[model samples]
Target: MQITLMRHGKPVLAASRWLAPCEMGHWIAAYDEAGVHVDAIPPASLAAASTAVIVFASSLPRAQSSARALGHAAPRVDALFREAALPFPLWRCPRLPPFAWAALLRLAWLCGYARGADALATVRQRARAASAQLIAAAAAGPVLLVGHGIMQRLIARELRAAGWTAVSRHRSGHWGMARYRLD
Candidate 1:
């Protein structure tokens, strides 16, 4: 069976200006609410999605929109597959681009700087649970997941741990896909 963990399409939101560390909280909120550019989904990825027996999407707006772009008028929306909560750093730091804040926050989160947000351990558990669901669905046929970048990476790691092998990764920008197969 085949399984594909796909990053959602490019979001409509933009980092038009530099932001202070504190401003990133608001940016994160907007990012969570943003919809994807549906037209940007590559034809090849769309074709792959169309072949899936089941399509799943994180409950976030971006992910849900990506599923529709893949031709699934309605996909199984699962909050369990949502991206790990980004920790909002409330410390003083040099003002940087919004994307820079995102990258720094992610790095900080990895280094155990999460204040009261979703702990790293919690994310790992969710990844395992979501991975199991995909594996179960694979028994029936192909499964496609249109999810966030980091969430897709987490799921891919879980799939590899479960003995699935990587097939190919499409260079489709935000809509890129990491393919895996149980052989």
Candidate 2:
């Protein structure tokens, strides 16, 4: 009854410079080289067939590419797992100063403070809700969800809060692996 959520690996940037959008409903860009390099695959006790019956990813090319490279069969692109849309697209403007970036991250966190809304809170809520749905729908098995960084982090937090045992956070790459042992 465990749900393992892992973030996608390192990707080549599709944009030359960071920019933000001036409005909402903008299409989030995908990673150019989004899959893990073969050499970067990490060792893991879990595989696609083991406890992983369901695989979900954000509706971004990078996420989908990563899932495919990892040999996840029929990985579904779930909108709920997509990264929180920025108030503006990051690539629309010149990169912000370091302090400004930090402030922006903080603001993003605050904005996602509620559930089922297109904010960070909503992403977390969706991840958990999806996980719960899988646990209920699956008789007894492990599930895999390939998602973005923020969504994975939120999932880990929720799992920790629910007392599920999990692996330490793994860095970005094709071989990144994190596990949650749902009781």
Candidate 3:
């Protein structure tokens, strides 16, 4: 059985501005609500979507819209595939771009700074569950999951642990794809 994890298309919400750490919550909220940028979707992603017998997506607007943009009008939407929550530090100095803030906050979260977000352990458990669900779905045919980058990485790790071989390099960027198969 084969399963492919694809990061959703670029979000419509631009992350060009520098933001204070405390403002990350509002930024994240807006990002979660934003849809995909249709024009930015890679051609390879569309080709990958066409080959899947079943499509799954996170309930977040970006993922859902990405699925639709890829022509999966009725993908199985689930909160289980949502991105891991990001924790924002309260420090007011050193404002950074959204990407930098996200990276730094994610690293802090991994180091146990989950003041207002799900713990790393909790997200790992969820990844295990999500992996199992995807594996089950792959029993019938190829499965494509349109999901967030972090959650997709966790799920890919779980799949590898479960003996699935990577068929392609896992891509973490928007519109990137990773393919795996169980022998």
Candidate 4:
């Protein structure tokens, strides 16, 4: 069985300004609601979306937009595939780009400061469940999942631990695909 995991297309939001911690909260909310840049989808990803027997997407707007952009019918929307929640801290530091803030906050999250989202352990459990569900679906034919970068990484790790082989690199870029095979 083949499982192709694709990151959703690039979001259409602008991140040119540095964001304060309080501003970051609003920024993340907007980011979550933003859709994808339809013109930026890679050709290979679009083709994979068309050929896969089933396409599953996170309920997030970006993933849903990407699924539709690929000329596929409405995908099975599953919150299980949602992006791991970002936990921003109230740091009294200079503002930074959204990506930079995300990097720092993720590091903080790893160090045991969950702003409020599920703990890392809980997220891991969810990944295991998501991977098992995908594996079961793959029993019939090839499957494609358009989801977020972090959750996809977690799911890929779980799949690897379960003895599945990764056929593609674990890329986190927009439209990047992670291919795995069950031998």
Per residue, candidate 2 scores C-alpha lDDT tens digits across 135-168 of: 5634456677777665676766766776777754
Off by over 4 Å in 2: 18-39, 45-51, 89-117, 167-175
**What C-alpha lDDT, on a 0 to 100 scale, does residue 99 get in candidate 1?**
87
> Which clashing pairs does model 4 show?
none
Give lDDT for model 3: 0.93
Clash totals in order: 0, 15, 0, 0
All candidates in order of TM-score, best leading: 3, 4, 1, 2
What TM-score does prediction 2 earn?
0.67
- TM-score of every candidate relative to the true structure: 0.94, 0.67, 0.95, 0.94
| Residue 65, candidate 3: C-alpha displacement in angstroms | 0.5
Highest TM-score against the true fold, candidate: 3
Give candidate 1 misplaced runs (Cα > 4 Å): 170-172
Q: Deviation in angstroms for 121 in model 4?
A: 0.9
Candidate 3 residues lying further than 4 Å off, grouped into runs, are: 14-16
lDDT on C-alpha atoms for all candidate structures: 0.86, 0.58, 0.93, 0.87
Model 3 CA lDDT for position 109 = 93
lDDT of 3 by residue, 1-183 (tens): 999999998888764689999989999899899998888678888898999999999999999999999999999999999999999978787888988998999999989899899999999999999999999999999999999999999999999999999999988888999999999
Candidate 3 pairs with clashing backbones: none
lDDT of candidate 4 over 1-62, digit per residue (tens): 98999999989897568878767788788889999998967888988887788889999999
Q: Which candidate is the best by lDDT?
A: 3
